[model samples]
Structure formats: C-alpha cells, structure tokens
Target: MSVQEWSADAATEIVRAHSGVRGALLPVLHALQERFGHLGPEATRLVAKELNLSRADVHGVVTFYSDFRTAPPGRTVIAVCRGEACQSCGSRELERHAQHSLGIGFGETTADGSVTLDQVFCLGNCALSPAVQIDGRLVGRVDADLFDRLVSDAAAR
Candidate 1:
C-alpha cells in the first residue's frame, strides 16, 4: 500500500520531522502506529530513507516487536493470552477454537476486516486463564462457542 493511502498529512509530517533524530526508531514507530494503526512496507521504506537507515533495520525492529504491525488492524483486536498462566489454563485450546471460529490464524485479520487475532504473552489475568481480549477488554473462560459469540458480536457492532 502507498503511504498516501494510509497516512494522514499529520502522520507523514510526524514521520519526517523525527526521521533524522538519533535512536529515533522507537518513537517514530510509535507515532506511525498511532497514526495508521499499523506500519506497512511502504511506511517502513519511507522511514528508512528519511532516517538514513537500511530497510532491513526498520523491518527488523518491527518484526522484533510484536506490537508493531505490518498490516492494517481490523475493527476489533482479538488477543489470546499465551502466557504460562493462561497456557496452564487451556489457552492453547481456546486459541485453536478462536482461530477456527474466525477462520483466520494468529496474527491474521478476518476476511471481512472486522477482527484481528493476535497472540499475547500475558494479560495479567492469569486467574482468568484461557482468557481472550477484544479491543482490550478481557473475556475469561473462553470456549469455542464463546469465541464464536464474541466474533459475532463484534461483527454486529
């Protein structure tokens, strides 16, 4: 996608203004993600060029940080906690159920672009293990049916 398509003039201006600062990766990346919801290839290349850094450098940072996204987000973010606590509480099973119900694997957006499924190491909700978060709101004791219900609700909204 083109930068013009995703970024507002304000977002682009932010990128340009900070591109030349030393150790600017984290800040610039945060601003870009805040503006566009995610960082695409075009944005990375633009940032690299503006900052006098290699595209690989930009890409590396993005990939290294799971918080950075290379594609646009869906209307709702469905994050499954993969932390040890959640894992012990059947988080993996819940993850599979969510993926199947959504028809999209982890780190992928639904075809309708309504939801994005992601994996998180922890959500600090271990007591409610096997938890799911939609738009940052935690839902505990997630099962296949519950997962379906959440997706359906998000679609309706």
Candidate 2:
C-alpha cells in the first residue's frame, strides 16, 4: 500500500495482533512497516500508546535500526558492502562511483524514485570483496562497470 493509504486503525490492528507476545516492540514495528512500507509518526505513536511505552522509546528503536525506514523506499534498493574486506578491495571507490552515477548518497533514493542506495557492513562475500546486493540478491566482485550496469538495470525495472 502507499504511504498515503496508511491508517491508524490498520496500525492498531497490527499492534493488537502482536500485543499478546513477549517483547512485542520489534515485531510490532516490523509488522507495521511490512504493511505500510514504512513506519510513520502515527504508527509509532499508536504503538507507543498500545505498549504503554514512551514515544521516544519507539522512535529510538526505529532510528537505531537501519532496517527501519521512516519513509518509503524506491523501486529498487542497492546495498553496497562496506565491510573491511570489501573496503580493502576498492569498495570506497565503488561507493563514490555509485554516488556520482546515481546522484544520491547512501541511504538516499534517486529523484526519479527508481533506486535507493544503502551501505551494508557485509554480504558474506568477503572472498569476493566489493560486493553489492540488488533487490536482495547478492552480486560480488563488483567493479565500476558492473555497478553501472546494475544501476541501469534497476532503473529500467
């Protein structure tokens, strides 16, 4: 669903669905985000009230986790690995090329709403350093040419 279609009632239902469990905060947040694509202020407040926790508590958790998004994602998410292994293999240059090629930095989406660039600590492809993940699929041993082709393919999608 679109961000414009998110409702408090739906958010509340999600909270109620997970309220009977132990340590419901993370699950509830994940549920809300799954349903709405992102957790907005309304859902955060509702979750806080339902769980009897401060809004700050909920907000803090959301902000602290890179997986949680306060806004909607683009059509495709490209996560470039920035781990020690990847960095040692020219991931820094890859990152700079991505920023320049996409006109957006890590954690930001392109203006046309086709791609969102993110930085991941690792993708378990240390052997194939300088890895990148496109739409949840891992691509390793990436260079500038490969990165450009991936970005182009994602934008086309």
Candidate with the greatest lDDT versus the true structure? 2
**TM-scores of all predicted structures:** 0.80, 0.90
Q: After superposition, how far is residue 87 of candidate 1 from its true place, in Å?
A: 2.4
> In candidate 2, what are the lDDT values of residues 1-157, reduced to their tens digit?
4344788887888899986799999998888888888888987888989999999999999999999999988988999999999999999999999999999999999888889999999999999989999988999899999999988887776
Stretches of candidate 1 off by over 4 Å are 1-5, 16-22
lDDT of 1 at 120: 85
Query: What digit string (tens of lDDT, one per residue) describes model 1 on residues 1-157?
Result: 2223475466668877884687888999988887778898888888887788899999999999989988888888999888898889787788888788778898999888888999988888888778888987998877778888988898888
Candidate 2 structure, TM-score to reference: 0.90
Q: Which stretches of candidate 2 lie over 4 Å from their true place?
A: 1-4
